[model samples]
Target: MEITILVFGQIKEITGIAAWQISGIKSTEELAAKLVMQFPELALMKYAMAVNKILIQTDTELNENDTVALLPPFSGG
Candidate 1:
């Protein structure tokens, strides 16, 4: 299955892309591991995942065509 990942904040800055695609992804945990493997820079950052517009925790099962958003911590006054 193919999944689209939306990168936000510092994550986008590190990846240099607003969005990216990955195939053969299963659970959120698996995705996180793979991301850290592919993008080593991500290993040092904290982030949240939103699957199909819904925030998810680790080990969340994913489905094909789901949109995953990787969001960093928000900052403002």
Candidate 2:
């Protein structure tokens, strides 16, 4: 399965990419593990995971071509 990960805020700076693709991810948790392994910087940051624009708290089932967004906490101006 190919998943598209969207990085935001400091994550974007850390990963140095707005979006990228990864394979063999069936759940959100698995993706998270892979991310931390690939980018050790992520474990030190705070963010939320969302699939197809919906915020997910637990390990959500993923499918091919799913777009997962990593969103950092937002602040109002």
The TM-score obtained by model 2 is 0.92
TM-score of each: 0.91, 0.92
lDDT of 1: 0.89
Q: What is the per-residue lDDT of model 1 for residues 1-77, given as tens digits with 9 covering 90 to 100?
A: 99999999999888888987888998888998998898899999998889998888657988898899999998887
lDDT of 2 at 49: 90
Q: Note the Cα lDDT for every prediction shown.
A: 0.89, 0.93
Q: Show pairs that collide, candidate 2.
A: none
Q: For residues 1-77, could you state the per-residue lDDT of candidate 2 as single tens digits?
A: 79899999889989999998988999999889899998999999889899999999989999999999999987868
